[model samples]
Target: MPGESVEYVVVHPDTPVGPVVGLFLLARSLEDAEEIGATVCGRALRTRAELSGFLLLGCEGRLVGPYFDRLLGWAPAGRVMPRPDHDSGNPFLDF
Candidate 1:
């Protein structure tokens, strides 16, 4: 029971929207996470709270801006996948 860890709910991407389901926030920099979001076609989402981080995005050309606009108001998506080079435990990523 000691030193136990929890796993996030994992979902594999299927439909174009599938990537949105398993989004997560990085404990690190918004800048680094935003770069990854841009890679997946999502823009960085900012909030009154600590930077909400990256979002899971589909092609904006395919979906209406209003849909994403409203979604962003709610969940404010995070990184869809952690970068392989990222050190999840170290927020500063010093290691």
Candidate 2:
């Protein structure tokens, strides 16, 4: 479990065919995750030019927009991982 990672997926559901989603990769470091997220965002944009308006990659503590030229890092709000220890607002709760 030491090698495990956390993933955050962003999706847009306004596509003509269907919803388009971009995933924030989980790797060694947050920097690496940003790199991978950027790549996924690029691919999503390339796949559908219209998806530009619905793209956002979760980086650090804030969501990374596609227009960003640099990656920003911030303190995580403990909303990482999908396990019981990582509390990202109770998944079973409904507002």
Every model's TM-score: 0.20, 0.35
Give lDDT per model, in order. 0.37, 0.52
How many residue pairs in model 1 have overlapping backbones?
0
Clashing pairs in 2: none
RMSD of 1: 15.9
Which regions of candidate 1 deviate over 4 angstroms?
Answer: 1-22, 42-95
User: At residue 25, what lDDT does model 2 achieve?
Assistant: 48
Candidate 2 lDDT by residue in tens digits, 23-93: 64446666766666566566667788676665454434344454332322332543322333347665442
Give candidates' CA RMSD values in order: 15.9, 10.2
Clashes of each: 0, 0
Model 1 Cα displacement at 71 (Å)?
23
